[model samples]
Target: MNDVTTDHADPRTVRLLVALYPARYRAAHGEDICATFAEATAGRPRSAVLRECRDLATHALRLRLRIGPTDPAGRVLAGAAPVALALAAGCAGYFLLPQLRELVHRIRYPYPGLGLGHAVLDATLQTAYTVPWLLALGIAALGRWRSARIAGGAAALLSVGVLALTGLYPYTAGQMATMALVGALVLLAPAGLVDVTRRGRWEMVGLALAVALPMIAVDRYGAQHLLLPVLALLPIWLSAVAAPALLGRLSGGRPDRLRAAGVGLGALPWLMPLAAVAAFDRPARLHTLLQYAGACVAPLGAAVAVAGAVHLARRVRTTDPADPA
Candidate 1:
């Protein structure tokens, strides 16, 4: 006996349920899903309608990760980001090796090598800004070691410390704020840090606070000349850290080199605006920063990405495996 009465139903409740799905997915099945919800809740109270809305959101997430049909394009894009990042890091390491080696040689000599000391310091600065080693470390901690939760929690604290020390910059973008939230969420998941739950959402909230508090405090107090440009940075750094899995998701089923290029090119739009800002505002300084940051961050992203790709690939190939990668 199915009893759904029209008298207790409200149409507005069904409309909100459609917002959960990714835009492409939503466009296809949203109508059917909402229609079913409407039919089932025809005479439900306002509170019941709200409950349905909550249920729809949860269902959409479940479908995205576990049940829904896989999107190959999404996977290919996801895979390519790490590959590109890895390649870039390799090139940087090739160039930086000589300087690092010379620095080590000079450090051993009886005389103090001021030039070599400067070179080492310069190399450190270069590596830190461009390479994103810390970002990769976080990814590896999450994906491979089964210590993502612990790693993420520790990183969260360190990130706060970094943000606090660099109080000279403004945290302007909503996207940056969102990325921090995502990072926090990633940190708060079980020691594995894979599942998305209410606790996960709270983790995101905590991360947002972690990032936001420092930015607010710094901007309110005083300004300092930090070597790394803060405003131009937080967005990319946060995005890279928060959405590390995006590249893997986009790489699709057995994505090849051309597909990888396509994915990298696709990411250019979001990148172009930042590049433009860096170019116009501090062209020479930006170039120097990019060089240094690239050297450091690229290798980190590569190591983690290759590890993840190998792990995921192996999982896809076998039911039971001796090693993950």
Candidate 2:
């Protein structure tokens, strides 16, 4: 009789493969699977070990989504933080920095003009500033939580330093604070709280596009015209209201009243710009419109954030089993 011993299979490798399963599944059957694999493949070909490892990974992913559930609040925060942080970085680098540089040059040179050198430098700086956040997002998508946290933290710190050094703090303190909050959420959230699944990646992409497309359109088509900027930003305002509701529905969790209310309140930031535009006569230039819009949105964003915190607290209280009934 031919023996099927797995002498060729490394025990350490077998254990590592078993660890790929979900936490619950590993706790339940990890040791048994490891032992069985070690015994059954004692003299088997290396191909058998590879096949088993592949199967383990597939099953692990399926079980992660099916059995090992995650908190909806955590999932939403985790999914949203990266997109918000990336947007913050991109805006600071691509939109704010060049303008600040031009202002400095105007003061120093007494005249300023767009030149090939300046354009190249601007593009280079923009790319440099944007790359770290992109890398962090990519790492987060792969479920490399630790790496993502490190990358995000580094990027946030870099942004803070740049803003402080350039004397742009007065203009961007609110944005910096928002970036800090997003960084903290990414770095401090518990393991498995952030779902790095394919669905999670798509959600991030959708949110990013929701924010980005309008900004791009405004910059390209509306920045030089009055009323056009307002029109372009209208989609962003609409998205702010729609995104949370859509995300909540797709999260696959039971609907909670507080969460819904929080999401509704969170949309207030987008509404504030529209309200400001309505209250005042149309601005003469694009910059004035943007300035007023930003001023209106920042305070409202804070209020909505507070509401979101209250919602999170309520969710925690409801989910906690040890609390007194």
Candidate 3:
């Protein structure tokens, strides 16, 4: 057995790896971990040391995201998973529904302005936006972390493809990229959260339906053709308004600021299709776009402000030490 305190060992790198462990775990096993890491990497080539660090980082992430997650940051990411999934699916559905309605009516491209090439582009856009994210979330819930990461990576790339397909509108493209970002976050989440229950899947599906069907209903039943954009987005508007208060109630106190922030972050992707509808999506109306945009921004803005305030206070408490009773 080689001595771990060898001079060739990179003590600083080893210490940083050890610090990635959960606080309690670090307190109990940190020295042993550092010793083992040091012993393994002493006099090793840079590439080998880098590989070792990567493996250790994965293990640390698993510990944080595993059943009964203990790390606060880990808990926040895991808690945010369901919320992100819902938002992503809802946005995808909102965009995909009109196309689906047209297909059902046997009108692939009713307008002379929308060519077959454009129809194919729209289908590809929806597939790229939606499928990989669903795959990433489902695979993670099933405890297949490697596959989840692959799916998440694919989701991110496909989302970029969706942006390119959109012809590069910065505001809408940035909004569209939110699912990619959410997918990236889930790439690190634990396997089999909530024992791999079906709850999360059903919730996402339900929200997607909730967002899409209402618009179709209003158009078909109430004869509110001009209000389709607003109807399509109304559920999201309500969610933005309701989520902060709902998170506060569920938290039973000072509000889960991190979770609220996550929900607000999740809401952003909806703006992509909303902007598209206002600017170019069929039934594009100048009249309601302002209302649509404001509905998207206001509640999310308030939630972000609160989250920022909480973060600033915590930073002050931690870094200032000026508290006086």
RMSD of each: 16.5, 13.8, 11.2
Q: What are the lDDT scores of the predictions, listed in order?
A: 0.44, 0.54, 0.60
- Candidate 2 Cα lDDT to native: 0.54
Model 2, range 187-302, lDDT digits (tens) per residue?
A: 54434555457875665555445555666566666677755455445434544534554345434345444333333333333333344444454456547656656644553355
Question: Candidate 1's residue-wise lDDT over 58-126, tens digit each?
Answer: 567645543322444333333333332322222223334435555566555524546656655555554
Poorest 10 consecutive residues of model 2 by lDDT? 264-273
Any runs in candidate 2 off by more than 4 Å, and if so which?
1-83, 86-125, 226-247, 250-253, 256-325
TM-score: which is higher, 2 or 3? Answer: 3
Which stretches of model 3 miss by more than 4 angstroms? 1-31, 34-55, 59-69, 97-122, 137-150, 188-201, 215-235, 238-261, 268-294, 297-325
Best by TM-score: 3
User: Estimated TM-score per prediction?
Assistant: 0.33, 0.46, 0.53
Ranking by lDDT: 3, 2, 1
Models ranked on TM-score? 3, 2, 1
The candidate 3 region of ten consecutive residues with least summed lDDT is 188-197
